[model samples]
Target: MNDRLGRLRDTTINLAHGSGGRAMRELIEDVFVMAFDNPALAALEDQAVFPLADLVRHGDRLAFTTDSYVVDPLFFPGGDIGTLAVSGTVNDLAMSGAKPLFLSCGMVIEEGLAVDILRRVAASMQRVAIEAGVSIVTGDTKVVERGCADKLFVNTAGVGVVPAGVSISARRAQAGDVVIVNGFLGDHGTAILVARQQLALQSDIESDCAPLASLVAAMLDTREDIHCMRDATRGGVATVLNEFALSSGVAIRIHEAALPIREEVKGACEILGLDPLYLANEGKLVAVVPAHAAERVLAAMHAHPAGRHAGVIGEVVAQPAGIVVLHTGFGGQRIVDMLVGEQLPRIC
Candidate 1:
């Protein structure tokens, strides 16, 4: 049986692996379990049990988040769905000023998928988990008819500890609060777009998919009173700003020239007739802080690798509540509204 499992390691997935029989057990034991080995995971049980003492030591609140990845092409220049799955959930927890602790991965795969490819993705997920100081403590696998599902899809749910006395929320933005972004926008969306090769365009752009817990920690260390934190994912910074504005009942004003965008990303957006502000990002974050703490938080962000391109792009305003306006480079102002239609789909 062990020899059979060993031989199957390098093979492609078949319908039998999802049949809830010996083949299924062997597949789980060989692939997911081995790749994401941990104390709770090694138990090979249906649920992951954590020590209450451990949870209480770091925080008084629990942060939980779940996200699903159905990105096309599976792999992009800088990251794949594997990294995105882990980073996406981690970033969600981080946005609440939490210390991400664990993740549960659920995979929906099409029959006839390559075992090697699944192994590679599992390995990538493991690597990213280690880098982000989290663990995949539990998971499930389901194989569907080949044509009914995409080649692969991943869903991740994560839990983290939010330190006592710390509060972060989109609704916390206040007038005079400064808005800061950790890095370039549109990189992830553009990278995925180029991967599609629909426009016959090419660029050196790559996805900025990464974990933001460390950067968040750095900022919180300096000042836990930072007003709000959000990962600019599906809707990009503009959309996030709109959300914050509506939630907090405050307007957001951003300076176009002050926004940090990579040249390659800018050129790609120009070519695609897309606005960078409306594009998606994976590793970037939007932080709002009181004017007094803005400089300190910005400094802390600059000190972190993930935030090297951090910039103060805007501020919260009192008038015209629930709106986001951008100061254009040409000395004109325009409303940056939530995208009415999908500018780019399945990019995340």
Candidate 2:
């Protein structure tokens, strides 16, 4: 039985591991199954089945989201592609005020990749899943020819339950609503740039990749009137604000002084000729809420470890609809336009 089951040794990945034969099964069992162990996945079936009653008890609607991670450096200062994949998906579901439940992972590995590296990535996914109170119930794996793909890529799809009577959307923002950001911006992008070591610069910046489910839940618990919540991702906080303005037909006005940025990240962006506002961040989120509830929600966010740096940076307005403007610290106001082109690609 042991011989028939095959084994995944501390060696490099080959094409046969994805062949759907005994090797493939062994790879799944040894790496993925061992790390993401749960009753649903332990079954080793093609699909995962859930109890309908349990799902219904959480909410009436289901929030489904999918994201693909192709970060250039597989590993960076604070996280890897595996950690980003899980956090990204969980944050997506949390954006809708949903309680994230299950996830599906898909891995595309290049031939000759180290088996130990795959193990490390799988372990990362498992750790993040356990921290977020979610499960990896189903998944698929594939291997590509050498040079056809990067060292590793991960794709995650997640589903969550949106509690009854909780409605959060970009279009829900209205005039007088306050804008709040959870923490520092541009950390992830700057960290990746520094990790590349292409520029001879030194700074202590780390990717802010983290699951935001708990933070979101805390905000919801304080009040269900959250107008909108979105993780500042690929295009950073600037892109998210523009999305909200366009979606709600409202203008957003932000104060430059209120924007939160790490000193290291700020210096790096200055040297790189980039704007921290346009840089990507993994763990931060932007939320819009009624002025009356802003203080309470901000207090709630401050209590959460992920949002200890929460700050109110902007407000929604009625004039100049579909636009975002930044009130400069220099007593000037300028349009915060949507990113014209990719500032930095593959940072995510």
Q: In TM-score terms, which candidate is top? A: 2
In candidate 2, the residue pairs with backbone N, CA or C atoms under 3 Å apart (3 or more residues apart, or in different chains) clash, namely none
Candidate 1 residue lDDT tens string, 133-176: 99999988888887978899999999999998889999999998
| Candidate 2 lDDT by residue in tens digits, 1-348 | 243355676488889988888778888888998899997886778899998788899899999999999997989999998899999999999999999999999999999999899999999999999889899999988999999999888999999999998999999989999999999999999989988985468877889999999999999998649998999999999999999999999999999999999888888887889999999999999999999998999899999999999999999999899999999999999999988899887987
Worst 10 residues of 1 by lDDT: 1-10
| TM-score, prediction 1 | 0.97
lDDT, candidate 2, at 168: 94
Q: Rate the local accuracy (lDDT) of all candidates.
A: 0.90, 0.91
**Candidate 2 lowest-lDDT run of ten:** 1-10
